[model samples]
Target: MNHSVTLKDIAKALNLSISTISKALNDSHEIGADTKQRVLDYAKEHNYLPNRMAKGLKEGKSRSIGVVVCSLDNNVIAQMLDGIHKVCTDKSYQIIIMQSKESEKLESACIELLYAGGIDGILISPAYETINFNYLLSLQESGLPVVLFDRLIDKIHTHKVGADNFKGAYEATKHLINNGYRNIAHLNTNTILSIATERLNGYKQALADHGIPCREELMVSCNYTGATSLNENLEEAIKSYMSLENKPDAIFTATDQISTRCLVILNKLGYRIPEDIALIGFTNTELADAMNPPLSTVHQPAFEIGKLAAEKLFSLIEKKNIDEDFETVLLPIDVQVRASSQPSNK
Candidate 1:
């Protein structure tokens, strides 16, 4: 009564064994309904607390997962987190979230901390600077399940879930071209990341398919991660394109941040959307509809990606064989056309 009540204390007070008290508290079917109710009521009244560390020791799992993302400032990331949280809640599991902020050191530290914290599984979106996946490999080798989502790697053989970047980018580019924009530019991210590289390829392929030659100078890479002056960098890229003698008549940005930023930069520079330079971007931001010209966008299935990733991680965690076959799930994307990408009046 003085100290925290334990299963032993509950058993002694109720004239039952410690095992019965524990099972009743856990709602085990082996215990009678009347006895289970009595135990639950007594525990609620007395505030009987179970030793979580001891339970984890017995089960060899913490019943918790660690989630890492590059950044959560974007609407896509926020929606993805909602999806992950939903699955975790349904499964009666807990999650610890972390942000890498696109730093390799921070990403590695997050993984290490999660592993040391006794997490049963990890869901991660690799940072832009994360080139080495040895730490992830080590975690899996040490009996922890890991599922990568969004920004994944080719070196690690693990479960992955992401949107089809190639198809999305190609569709966006073709949409712009079909809208009567001949000279188009691409605002991209780091080429090392699969997301960026795949998108760039798709844009080029779309141009080739339409008999439009790919112009190297029109392609500009934006460093969203670890950039000291992101706005200045993007402004410079935009100015460079606009200053060209045969500048781009339209632009397509690869990521959510890049897309939104391009719109802001273009507006600030006095370029009219769809009239001066048509614009299309890959983003999930709801405010895209409220833009001055109603921005066109390639919408990634962020929520579905998060849900699939978490479900896959749980599958790996619960399975007996850690080396079972892994999978890479690619969800489709939707291209929403708006006034920003259309020069003609609807």
Candidate 2:
């Protein structure tokens, strides 16, 4: 196996000191412009890469931030990451992204790896099975800053940025009720994440405010999974609800992907949306508009959530205390009333 090129090799080849090569490579103003250009040219020609581990050990910073998400295949998370990448690039910081695949063990291992790599900070949307707060707490105790995005543990006091899930759910449910659909079903994820709980609370609040009785049986919990598994679970939930004596007249999905699956199942079952059962979903996506009956949904600021989380994490890493005014940043959500949940034009 070919060994990686180092600064020592570059210094030796140029007959210059390691410090001079380092400064030149970094484009330090103290180094002569000609020497800096020459070093950069040589490094580029040789495809030389600095050893991040060695640099991190010497400077106490890796100039890289670690981000762990449940999955990279998730559209919402993908968008969020795009924003994070943009900001990190703008600030000349590198990012290390990891997918835990919804496993607590894998998430812990990824965190350990990032810590060992000497990351400057961490931003995470923890796995659904994440119950061990000790790992996160230990990082904080050891002076490693972490910012939680989208999902959070209430018991762990830390910086967090996400949408107003409660408000989004409330508005969605309230819209259904106002449209004269009292029997509403909520398709939610089976997890202890604060976002899911908050959304559920919002749904309940909306029902109470509208004088609609909350039915526990109407709530269906399923694990986050692939489209096939999600679709099967959704079909079962819809069938169970439709089989009930008091069948739901409307459904509020916890996510856009779930909403799409519900539409597919409804079509296969020969149920016309808004005519037989209205539908609303969380998370605004392009597919929402292209559906046979455009899906009504709550638009979340996914990119903003990522950007704010990164900004807060960097602030903490810079030795700035943000504890005095720790806040739950709630970005605004807009409800797009589409044909799926809207009253029939006929």
Candidate 3:
């Protein structure tokens, strides 16, 4: 058979009618097991692919999943995408990935294009600048399913999968405090997302619980602009922290980008990891262990988060008459110790 082999081609080759071939392919009750096996063997031999467009036209479903994220370059986001791909491919659904670069306007354009392209559903990690969920809410209300993952929003109630940011931050800060670092700084994104606030609160709670005062000047919120500006802001924040009369002895960063990038900025400024100032942050980069001092990090279960998000989205897509209540799944995170966050003396 040729590259575009069809039911007719298989039927002609097997000396069977197109109806028999179609029924066998569809696993209809009328098709005998022996005959079905014969047809399947022949179809598999010739690499037969179903015309999904035709099938979608009949069933009114494109069988495609649209995914939107801030960017596809990060190691954590890449792992999440792999999980999404694994589930979608296993369930015979195609994935279309788009990046918003943390811009709400770009994210909206991506969603509009996906909707116009007849996607069955969407799995999105909203941009940091995204404050309006009205558009997504309208689409979901109109029967287009949506499930949030990673950086989530609460305006539109639906299934969401993310890591326990509070717990991760708490553990990171607690670890630093336990190492005799009272003046611990926190580097976080300037966003209204629960991730930012929860992590910030966790850091504060850890400090309060440990009887250490939380320094207002040490809690710096970096803007979510492009990379150049972000690095500039982070450098300035670090410089200000160093100039403080009682600056931080250890630093805990929030998001993946802020975590890894802050380390680079600190090194560039000639700060010694752990000896002069300890460092830890939330990140999933494989190179964490390969950094100058082998960075400590709070690692989120990004792959599992992605898989669960897609699963929940599909559940919404194939909902039955019996409506189901939405759920928010927050997975645990791990705090991996490294030399970067060792004792201040080390």
Q: Provide the lDDT at 242 for model 3.
A: 93
Would you list the rank order by lDDT, best first? 3, 1, 2
Give the C-alpha lDDT of model 2.
0.85
Each model's TM-score?
0.88, 0.83, 0.95
Candidate 2 deviant stretches above 4 angstroms: 1-58, 225-228, 321-325
Query: Comparing candidate 2 with candidate 3, which one achieves the higher lDDT?
Result: 3
**lDDT of model 2, residue 339:** 91
Q: Candidate 1 or 3, higher lDDT?
A: 3
Which candidate number maximizes TM-score?
3
lDDT, candidate 3, 211-303, per-residue tens: 998888999998875898889989999999999998888899998888889889889999988888899999999999899889999999999
Give the least accurate 10-residue stretch of model 3, judged by summed lDDT.
314-323
Note the residue pairs that clash in candidate 3: none
Best by lDDT: 3
Model 1 error, position 106 (Å): 1.6
- Candidate 2's residue-wise lDDT over 1-346, tens digit each? 9967788999999999989999998779899999999899999999997776676667777789999998887778988898888888766689999999878899999999999987888999988778777988898789888888988778677788888899999999998888888899999887899878888999999999988999999999876745567778888999999999999989998875777778888989999988989999886577888887888988888888888888887778766775546667878788889998977642
Candidate 3 residue-wise lDDT at 85 = 89
lDDT of 1 by residue, 122-222 (tens): 99988887788898898888878889888777888889899999999999999888777889999888648788898999999999999999999999887
Give the TM-score comparing model 1 with the true structure, all chains together.
0.88
Which candidate, 2 or 3, has the higher TM-score?
A: 3
List CA RMSD, all candidates.
2.9, 3.9, 1.7
